[model samples]
Target: MLMMPLEIFATVATGLGAGLALIIAIGAQNALVLRQGIRGEHVGLVVLVCMLSDIVLIAAGIFGIGAVITAAPAVVVVIRLAGAAFLIGYAVLAAKRAVHPGTLHASTQTGTMSRKAALITVLTLTWLNPHVYLDTVLLLGTLANQHGELRWWFGAGAALGSVVWFSALGFGAKLLRPVFAKPGAWRVLDGLIAAVMLFLGIKMALGV
Candidate 1:
């Protein structure tokens, strides 16, 4: 069935709003992206990776991959466990950074991450996050399917939301460089990151 123009617009708007609601939340992925953005380390690549990942996941959900995933409980269990461990480990690192806060000019603290390391870290943060699957694949997919023939249009809006959000977060973080120039700010940011990671890690571990 061909959706009317107004119907298409409404579907797209709904998808965009839903996507932003889920993606805008504070999570490990956003924390890492914001940190990399502020440090000016692989910001473009990181943002691209995040946007692409979301697009792929959204597409998967729209195409019925979510059902396959749901049928395979083992896969989720594995991902959840792995994600929990990785999150906890990352939390420890963030806590250490918080304890030993470094100034923005400190190359060892802010600018020394190799491109390869940055890429790997961002990938792990994105893929290992089970919440990404739940939000993008299952939830958004379900929502899009409700649009019937306009589902792809909904998915496109969701993808655009991902692009807009990551672009804003990754690029906009640089504006805070002045505040981060002080070691105190770094300490606070890292402390918050640590807390978020730890909380998520524990929750995932318990399957909550």
Candidate 2:
């Protein structure tokens, strides 16, 4: 009977490790989240959206929806186009900010974004990335199925990994606020963001 608990723990650990492995990478989503975190703008909302999106995708994968997604090539193409366009547009905005960076003091929050805009941006960064679906729904789903009857537990662990990572990422970024207190810091940060978005957008559009 004691072995049963050990088995469950092992399964959960496997899921947690796999999920973190896939997510803990540098990408457009992570960059956006880090920017928002540094600004202290809707950090909770951004983290919630990211975590919930992962849960839904992971659950879909475990429930056998991954196969459906893999079979639909056209759906991927459409999403790729849409995501690319959004990324390019966002890149332009970032570039503009870098060029004309007005008051961006971290203390007074001179450039606070509206909650609605923040939510929309977060959702786009989370859902519009085709990689999210592939990683969470297809890859993670296949991995969880290896756990047999404990697959749900595996999924739960994967979900928990997302929760832990994003919570830390979004909240932990506050430490950088002091560094971004200067307008030049904002300019440099936005410049980097623009470069990433532009590169990813072009890559996506070219189907690379």
Candidate 3:
């Protein structure tokens, strides 16, 4: 089936809006990206990984992989429990950082993460979170299929949304470097990250 230009535009716009609405939320992934961006630590690689992950997930969802995953309740449970544990552990680390805040320079010196470590961390953050599967694979997949034959276009739009958002977040975080230069600012940011992670961890654990 052929779609009119207007139909394509509308479908893309809908996908873009839905994608942004889901991804723009404050979560572990966003927090890590923001921190990496502000610290000037492999921002491009981080953003690229995030973008590619989302694109792949969104594609999977649109292509019916979501249905296959959904058929296995055990898989979801395992992912949820594992995700909860990781988030909680990360929360503890964030709390420690909050307690002993460091200036941007001090962080750069003592907290510098190797590229391989950063890559692994970002990938873990992206893949370990069950919310990614829920949002990208199930929800977005369902939404895309609603577009019928234009489903791929919807997925493309959602993928573009991910690219736009992660690019903005990872690159734009440096603009706040001035504010984050102080130890107090680091404390506040880490405190918030810890709180968010803990809340999410607890929520996931309780299956709430």
Candidate 4:
């Protein structure tokens, strides 16, 4: 009566697919990760935080936590709006740096945020945002709920999948830092980040 294996594989696929979809994007989280990676910051700590946050949410979902989250519609709306606003704000910051490339500095020298602070910032931005719950918790959890006996395995699979993707991204960015150091490379990257955030913010605002 319990289809655990199917659930696990399905969940794993969902996790991997979602991770791949968003990992390479120029969103705030990825930008922070890449910045740290290039500066040779506390990458291990960042990866751990990223993965743990995901696991917590996924675990919460399997335990019916999403039902509670979904029940609070007003809270969801507020969080979504706040997240979108933050993204837009970050986008502006990125665009400003892009046009004024001289303002950009070594991430290591930027005393604005230390490695621990940076990692926490990414974790909060990622986990506290409503979109994360909607994608990983509610959607993926609901999928797992369908399997009578396989739901547990599905949840495990999804969790493992998330771990794999984020770990890779966290470590993989270091390899790209050199290529990104070419003149105007950061400008292009910042511009792309700005564009993506603007697009996502507008889409969320429009209820799209």
In order, the Cα lDDT scores of the candidates are: 0.90, 0.88, 0.89, 0.70
State TM-scores per candidate.
0.95, 0.94, 0.95, 0.82
- List model 3 lDDT by residue over 36-128, tens digit each: 898889999999999999999999999888898789867878888988998999899889888876522424678777799789878988888
Superior candidate under TM-score, 1 versus 2: 1
- Over the stretch 147-200, how does candidate 1's per-residue lDDT look in tens digits? 888999999999989999999999999999989887788889989999999999
Error of 1 at 119 (Å): 0.9
Between candidates 1 and 3, the TM-score winner: 3
lDDT ranking of the models: 1, 3, 2, 4
For 81-123, candidate 2 gives per-residue lDDT tens digits of 8999999999998898888887444456566787999899889
Clashes of each: 0, 0, 0, 7
Indicate whether candidate 1 or candidate 2 has the larger lDDT: 1
Better of 2 and 4 by TM-score: 2
Q: Which 10-residue window in model 1 sums to the lowest lDDT?
A: 102-111
- Residue-by-residue lDDT tens digits, candidate 4, 96-126: 8788876765443543457667766787668
- The per-residue C-alpha lDDT of model 2 at residue 160 equals 93
Q: Which candidate number maximizes lDDT?
A: 1
Question: At residue 60, what lDDT does model 4 achieve?
Answer: 85
Query: Model 2: how far is 145 from its true place, Å?
Result: 0.9
Name the weakest run of 10 consecutive residues (lDDT summed) in model 4. Answer: 104-113
